[model samples]
Target chain A: MKTTFSLALAGMLLSTTAALADTTITIESWRNDDLTVWQQKIIPAFEKEHPDIKVKFVPSAPTEYNAALNSKLDAGTAGDLITCRPFDASLALFKKGQLADLSDMKIMSNFSDVAKAAWQTDDAKHTFCVPMASVIHGFIYNKDAFKDVGIDAAPKTVDEFYADLDKIKKDGSYTPLDMGTHDQWEAATMGYENIGPTYWDGEKGRKAVIAGTEKLTDPQFVEPFKQLVKWTDYMGDGYKAQTYPDSQNLFTLGRAAIYPAGSWEISVFEKQADFKMGAFPPPVQKAGDQCYISDQPDHALGLNAASKHKDAAMTFLKWVGSQEFAQIYGNALPGFFPLTKEKVTIKDPLANEFLSWRQSCKPTMRYTYQILSRGTPNLENALWAASANVMNKTETPEQAAEELQKGLASWYEPQQK
Target chain B: MAQDRKPVRWHVGVFLAPAVIVYTAIMIVPLFATLDLSLYEVRDKVAAFVGLGNFAKLFGDPNWSGQFWNALWNNTWFFVVNMAVQNPIGIGLAALLSSNRLRFAAAYRTAIFVPTILSFVIVGFVWKLILSPLWGIAPDLLKSVGLRHWFAPWLGDPHTALTTIALISVWQFIGIPMMLIYAALLSIPEEVIEAAEMDGITGMSQFWRIKLPLILPSIGIISILTFVGNFNAFDLIYVAQGALAGPDFSTDILGTFLYRTFFGFQLQLGDPNMGATIATVMFAIILVGVCVYLFGIQRRLRRYQF
Candidate 1:
């Protein structure tokens, strides 16, 4: 009995020493597709830098992530690092003290104010998450189909865009626009928001609307819906029932000429498309007009307030905000551009093409994301239906705009007045 | 005589204890808790008692009331579709299967009842794939029958989406009513049918006059079950059309609306108080329906001992 007790005491001492040497911290994320990338490339690089801090990436399905994370946080069983969805979702967590304030961290200096804006409090006094990546919105077109239609250059203006689409329709070989209304989000995200930025003049119009200086019924907002309605003729037959995947498949199969896309589609399109693909920013209203792109911050990383291994998690986050980490992640995931201000060279040509638009066009996030969607009858969801209905010819752009404005006015104090 | 009163029946309490405890824990407690939760509202992230404020908002606020009424209307249509199409078809199939002249009756029953055993996810996905305009077999199959122009994207059209989904649900759940009514039809004593035949009632007339009347009690039970089931339905619509029940929320039923409100969807935060209000309303609806069936309908239906 004495020998057994002595052995057990020695085992406990060894385990404690091991624990002191190494702290294993887990990260919770919704990006299940990035599991292999995290496991094979990212984790190894981080582990090589800090051997004392072992990292684990645990992911749930994207749709279930918010619910699962909320429940886990409530149960006090969440991981050390939590992947943050931009804007109000993460802001709500920070407000609840579930996410640690990262303002004091030296790594917070790496990102621009615009990059960090998503995970900050309304007053911008407290920053919560380390901004990671942003997806730029534009058009990804099949070069072969464009050649077949005899359109040598990407459209620089809305009129040129319609002309090119008409040429493609006349060619009778490929569908001009490859988006669908079935999923609803694509109608708003890729259809309206993609081209809407140019009409709204990017951040200028976006902030004005938020400040109640501009209404959705304003011509700038309504024009995007009008442009979206014009897409119906180019969408070919049975586009109403076409799902996101169907649209993707149609483009990759070389059946469609142009795809309204977020930059996130770059890697997938690169893998799937046999034809050469090219991207262009949203067309301007007229020649010499400044263009704009929806450069939305998609994801971030934050330290869990209840985490036991704060030091290890902070160390990991600091690395995530580093120039080296930016280079690696930017190259590793082509479409998901690193949000850091550091100049990271993109290896993928299509992604680089998408990145180049940042030089010419003003960048703005999706308008409905930040503070407008907090009330009943969420503006973002309302936009999904409105965008689809306009395309379906069920509701005119004027009516859709009026309805959205009225709904916003009902609850939002700024819009009410 | 007072001294001879029955001793305490400890075994009776023991026999009932487990079921009573389990039911109370799972069902009765949550039901009451949901009702209680509906009376509260979240203010500055703290749940404060607001009495009937949530109900008032649900019925009074334009945004909330519009969604509530739309969902209620859609749910009513969904139930109506099942009652009009599924139950009648189920009865017809059950009648045919119960007929003595029918061959391969067991095979037909198994084949027809197979869909009820499948998961909602599988059924929803398969139907979606089959009906898809881009890659689905629906258009091609129609073309082969020389009716190519007749085929449209039914599931994607706002006007047809709800009805199409309702029909798909009918296809899945028809087996349930069929099996129930089949059993009810089988349990009827053979002598009653012989007596009906002797009285000159035959064929369709015989079924209408004797079998259907005899099975009225079973039919009543099925109607109540369907009402409760339809009002509570969520899975099939969720799996098929998503949380928004797209094509302009044309297919948004009460269950899906409640789910979106309680759990939140996309960018919207979940309002548990509003969710609870919707749930409480749903419970009340189902309760009133069941009560009406019990007191008004079921009581009127004659149950034959034979």
Candidate 2:
């Protein structure tokens, strides 16, 4: 009996040592849709490279992620690896010391300043998260619908774009523009931000607005709203009540001509759209003008400050920044273009078309994402309402711009002065 | 001597302890904590006592005050819609069901009450689909009836969105008041009803002159319940219109406002201080409403003992 007890204790100690040898780190994410991709491909690849470090991808619904993660962090139960949102949301966590400073990490060298800007401090001194991927905004059109409407090529200028819309509208079968104001964010994101870059001259106007040299009421910003108002003329009947999914269905069902799209829609559209789909960057105001696109950095990964397995988590993050991880993640999620300095070949054709825009057009982040939205009457939320109102014909472009300017000037110090 | 003395009755305390402890832990503690939190603001990540400064900001600041007042006005309208439309319809349904002449009363009651048990997510999503122009049957159904023109995008229009949502909510909760009033009508002792019948109070007059007064207390209770529920309503609007309560925030009520402030929406970060302040204001409004019902109206109501 004594010999058996000693042998059992020894075995238990050996098993404990074996478990400790392989550090298991979990990743908290909002992308529940990507669970299978992480489990089947990404995790296995990482584990093979680092046999001693095990990885787990745990995800909650996107809508509840922020609240859920915050409570977990507070309770000291957050995962070792944290999937970060692009801007102020992650910055807040870093400020509270819930996320570790990854500025000194060797993997930080893999990304450019533009890619890291989303996760960096306002002063751009310390970086907290490793850049993962970005989604480019443009217009996706049904090729068959375009053909039926007697249009052969994507429009090159704003006037030409409207002319195509007019042709599509005149055709009587297809809705010219497949978009809606019911989910207000789309009105701002895929509607305003998608085209506003062309008018604002991309980063030039975006930076100017942040610097307080140019107000939202400026012509550069108001022009986009004016353009959005024009889009209402081509939208289908009852477009006012149509939702995001409704618009997607309308486009994919080949009933609509063009869809103002984010590159993220590529995977879904590829699967759903039976007809050949083509993408075009936002048309410039005139032919031969310099084009701009809103290539917003959307998601990234970071080390949780309270993590027990910091070294193992760092190893995973380092692998995440590698060319191998980018290729796999970029291909697995076609629309999510990896933000690495190293070149990556995209597998999806629609995504490739979106990526091709980067060659000709200048890339800029969404204007309100950074410091401009930190104050009351949050600029991002205001833009959503304003954009929706503009599209609904409830607010004129000038009025919308003035409201935004007034709201910004209320608390934003530079704007006030 | 022992037999003459009163028992210690320690068992009574034991019996009450579970409920008292649970209630205090879940309800009382959170209520006081929320009130306490309302008095402080977080600056530089540290919570400091601000002593109603947040309230001042909520009221005095144009930005905060604008949203607060808008939400408050919308909440009042939601309650008013429930009082005006839901309760009357409920009473009518109950009166019809209580009459022995009506057949399959149980089936009708069950059918009407079915929506009350459905989750808000299902109700919101189902209604959205039903009303959608792209896939919804609303337009087709209306067209079949030659009333297609009447089917505007009510959910999408800022002018009609709030009323549409309120009506949907009324549709779901009408059964509550109906069941309550039904039970009240059934409890009217047969002798009292018979006495009214012999006095030549029959048909509609019998309902108004005899039965209505007796159920006045139940009606009052239903009104207060509707008021409380409407003021606290959030899920339907959130699930339908989203956190911004958009199309120019026409559907925003105090509940959504508090949620957005507390949890933040999209790129906006949550501010617990402002959230607590808004919550306290809601608490005060609810308290005042309940107080008026209890002291002003409920006190004056005559409870019939037939």
Candidate 3:
């Protein structure tokens, strides 16, 4: 191993003395204790294998990850291999031609079919990205909490869901639903991005909107907002007081009987001392129980298009594609669900159930707020404001919908000018 | 002519040259380049001159007008909270601790100053978690008293989000101006204070009449600095809230708005042209603020050298 390692390094370093010596391979990898541990222990093995190449790690916090990466790209100092989020912003970068296409890499064939479809352009000849891990976000319920309230399991219809929530409250549970409108977008995230399109974009509704045949003021959009208000109202008074983590914490601590959130958060609840938490598909409508569940491609990654060291970059990305490495990585990552054929055995039965249950879902549609909703920055800002406004009653759902259409008209009309 | 030749102002220019070059290259050039970039439209990898179009869109166009006004309004409130809360608190602490009789004053100053040393990201997350209902010490502290009911998740609430963040910022930054004003307050000649004491002006009276007059310039300087730093600030709000400034964007300031516009989040493409326009507007806002302080406020206030 040393002979193989030393030879590779010695060749890379000596073969290109001055020119290649300066060509340092910079990797803008994420900072995770587990991932860092792997980088520290395993990367040196790769480095030892290739001596001429020296790796410089530019570690950034998760919050600063996108901004820092953007600054680096703007300055043209962005490194060879960078982590990519699956959000619409990444698509914006792809349009800018900033991302490297590694479609030709044999390792790409190993990607999950869903993962491949999400990252690649319509022309399968190009693949601009890969994923960190498969992130599964769906509605999760506490089975024990339900049983205590005399409900056996999750409801298949919207009516049964509300009935179960009522039962929980009737049983003297403080709050049946932990819908935290304190973060306004959480309401829309649950009401719209995760579910609205499930029905809105479905056969009858989408055509109406697309044909300009349906005003957003039409009951289609208004009904969801009203539904959201009702669901939120069930949380009792002082609803404005709830925060995201606060609601999640309440459910985990058993202060609340039920919660709606992403499956990615299962590991966080599992750390609680008591009670079992499990995942379920989004609540179905009694009128349309036969509709499909909305889903999206989760936690994806991509390579930099302008990377100087494509071979080494390809090697690293290739490792990410391997099911064995992905399984090892995902198991250690806690909340992540790897999309490889080889399953990493999860310790939490609830988390395992979520991963297994998700196989049947048909993703509703893919439009993160930042991307799909309103395209203009100012309009996006308004739409976001409207979410909070609806909760506060400062703006009605009809007003909110009008504001969005007006926002689009403002941008579109001006661009025409 | 040879004998009349001036000595080549040797060391000053020589010493200044490197710094001047570096500063001009790093700061001034980039600043002006950004301003110049504001006047152009991007197409086919080339920038075509578009006189005041970006500015027109930012200020005049209805599409952008609301967001611009909202951000401006939020930014104004964000700065006002700091001036009202951070500056006065800092000044008071500096004045109190400057008294020679105060015991363990050095320790107090260090303890107060330590938060300033933390990065914004750290402070944002630390305060966010601390104020959290889960794993937070703030709730427990409040619960210890009868005030547990008042323990709302401040950071996550839209109505209170920006104001809550402003206070956290003040807590982190109070040390900077505290140390500045403390030094200014300490440098006042002892003879002047002694005279005031002899004249029967003492304690609170002496501070108001004697100490504050002398430290007016320092206050003005700290004010301008707070204005500049607050106006330019992005990290604190950004970390506590995502780029979207969640909970309905109740916390969108010029900095975040500028960032989202320039960098393009979600579906929005990063428009260097528009970003430059936002930056120029910021520069104008900051310039007006500094000018008002220097020419207007400072001129009106008499700095008594007693």
DockQ, all candidates in order:
0.68, 0.70, 0.28
Looking at model 1, the pairs that clash are none
Better of 1 and 3 by lDDT: 1
**Which residue runs does candidate 1 get wrong by more than 4 Å?**
A1-13, A20-24, A50-54, B1-3
| Two-way lDDT contest, 2 vs 3, winner | 2
Could you estimate the TM-score for every candidate? Answer: 0.96, 0.96, 0.81
lDDT (Cα, tens digit) per residue for candidate 2, span A167-212: 9888889989999999898999999999998888899999888888
Instruction: Assess each prediction's global lDDT (C-alpha) against the native.
Output: 0.91, 0.92, 0.71
Worst 10 residues of 2 chain A by lDDT: A61-70
In the range B1-306, model 1's lDDT, one tens digit per residue, is: 988999999999999999999999999999899999999998887989999999999999999999999999999999999899999999999999999999999999999999999999999999988998878999999999999898888878999999999999999999988999999999999899899889999999989989999888877878888899899999998888888898899999999999889877878777778999999999999989899888998777777897
Q: How many pairs of residues collide in each model?
A: 0, 0, 13
lDDT of 1 at B250: 90
